[model samples]
Target: MSGAAFETIASLVRTRAGIVLGADKAYMLDTRLGGLMRELSLASLDALAAKLRAPGSERLAAAVTEALTTNESFFFRDGKPFEHLKRVLPRIAAARGPAQKLRIFSAACSTGQEAYSIAMVAEQLGLLPRLEVLGTDLSQEVVRRAREGVYSQFEVQRGLPVQMLVKHFKQEAGQWRVSPALRAGVRFETGNLLADLRHLGNFDVIFCRNVLIYFDAPTKSRVLSALADRLAPDGVLYLGGAETVLGLTERFTIIEGERGVYAPVVRMAAAG
Candidate 1:
């Protein structure tokens, strides 16, 4: 691909998704976009770029953005976060009044594993009756798959415990399908984190893990601030190990002893 073609595609992706593709990722563009090329019957990457530049190319632009967005995820990824959740559920439950629901948001939740894992854990702990797990991703394809609650044998094996698997999944035609009871109250929707999130409502726990690393500093700060605004008082946020709110925004502070967990900062009142 010519330099001009590369830049045009990269610019469209960044504008549409807030994902910055550096010069080193030129090869990634070629590999990821190959399928789109074939789907569009384009002769080369340059042809695809030309199509993207044409008028009324919103659909093509969306295809390119989806192609570039990474969707890698597994059940209960990075065990520590789930472990912490198991320990803290009682406290979150206690804070809620009778019949009140606890909300958990799995932001950028690719293919729904993380959200389903949380639902499984809550069910195991007897908290599923009062919990709602919302899994959102930018890709419509992944969101639809997540809502289906079907997983391949390989997908089921990753980070999903054997006992839980036996208890929560039913094997059908070689794929593991999440039990209907386990699927209750767990919803999946297509959403962009960089867009307005107020309609999603406040959450007691928000898992925006591993997604912020793709954004530039300004976008990161803006996204974090928006998350903070959506967090209920006493709510907690979990970020990826490599990501943090430090120097990005002052709206949150680390929860001591909890790796990757953060709480909204509380400012003390002035002395009388």
Candidate 2:
């Protein structure tokens, strides 16, 4: 990637995705955009960036965004979090009841693993009806793969247990695959955390783990606060174990159990 093109695309990404790619990330850009160039049958990264910046090129912009969006994920990536989810399930189910569903958002869900993991747990607990899961990402490519829900053996092996491997995924001609019934209540969409999430609908629990580190402090604060606003009063927020809500957003209250968790700070709406 040329210096000018790199600057332009990096600026566009930071503006659109809230990700700050440093000067050292030039090599990464070259490696990634090279693939994008080949896939689109384009001449070069410069041409690709020009097309991205061209008028009436929403598709090109989306392609660039998806190409640049990070897609790292695995099922039950962290054991403690899923363990915590199990304990919280019954209480959340009782609190939500039948009329209202227990909505969960896996923000930055890379390849449907987190959303499908939640679905499997909820179904196993007989809480699927109480659960409606949505997985979202900044990349159109990732969201599309997530909707597909097919994983290779190596992909499923990461953070997945042997017992679960036998139970949830079936061997599809030697490749591990998620069952259809387990995926019935999930949806995936392309969304940027830097933008308004109102159109994505409200969620009772949001899993935005390991994503904020890529953002600057101000960007992280703004994004977390917005997520807090969209959260239900009693909604729980889950972040990576290495991450915390302290000093970022006062609108969330940290809850400690097997591992720590964050819940929305409940406020009473004014009576008319």
Best by lDDT: 1
The CA lDDT of each predicted structure is 0.90, 0.82
Candidate 2 structure quality by residue, lDDT tens digits, 46-117: 887788777897776666766777788998888777878888877877887677888899999989999988
Task: Provide the TM-score for each candidate, comma-separated.
Answer: 0.96, 0.89
lDDT of 1 by residue, 1-272 (tens): 99889989999978888988899989998789999898878989899888888899999998889989999999999999998899887789898995999899999988999998999889878899888989898899999999999999999999998998999999999998998886896999899998999999999999999999999889999999999988887888999989999899999999998788999876577899
Best by TM-score: 1
After superposition, the stretches of candidate 2 with alpha carbons farther than 4 Å from their true spots are 40-57, 257-260, 268-272
Write down the worst ten-residue block by lDDT for model 2: 252-261
